[model samples]
Target: MNSWVNASKFFTGASTVGSIAIPAILKHAGIIGWGALAMELSSFFIFVIAIMCYMSMYDEDGYSSMI
Candidate 1:
């Protein structure tokens, strides 16, 4: 009967921890999703910044030149 009591205690502890952790796991995944999106958008912004810099540097006597 002691073994049964120990087994019950173990499962009860595991269930309690699992109940607390499931929502935390989902929240972590959601945060990672947004982090990935932010990383992608930052890369896109870097490309845009590079293009603007290149364009501004290519002006010829206030005249626009196409590359």
Candidate 2:
């Protein structure tokens, strides 16, 4: 679990750096809009997946109890 947590942190940091760097690289290449759109979609999918994972942590009974 600790290893997983450390790996997650490392990837999260790499993701942050890439998010900052990729746009500028794309803009220099003359595809800023396309690159930005792709990044936005990627972020949205990551968000959805994170939400799904969070929801899955709750059992059926636990989910019902939320309401």
lDDT of candidate 1 at residue 66, scale 0 to 100: 47
Model 1 TM-score, 2 decimals: 0.43
lDDT of the candidates, in the order given: 0.70, 0.79
Cα displacement (Å) at residue 26, model 2 = 0.2
Across 1-67, the per-residue lDDT of candidate 2 in tens digits comes to: 9999999999989987777677767777887687585777688679879988989986788668788
RMSD after Cα superposition, model 2: 5.6
lDDT of 1 by residue, 4-57 (tens): 999999998897566546545655778546555556556656876998999998
Number of the predicted model whose lDDT against the real structure is largest: 2
Model 1 misplacement above 4 A: 31-67
Deviating ranges (above 4 Å) for candidate 2: 33-67
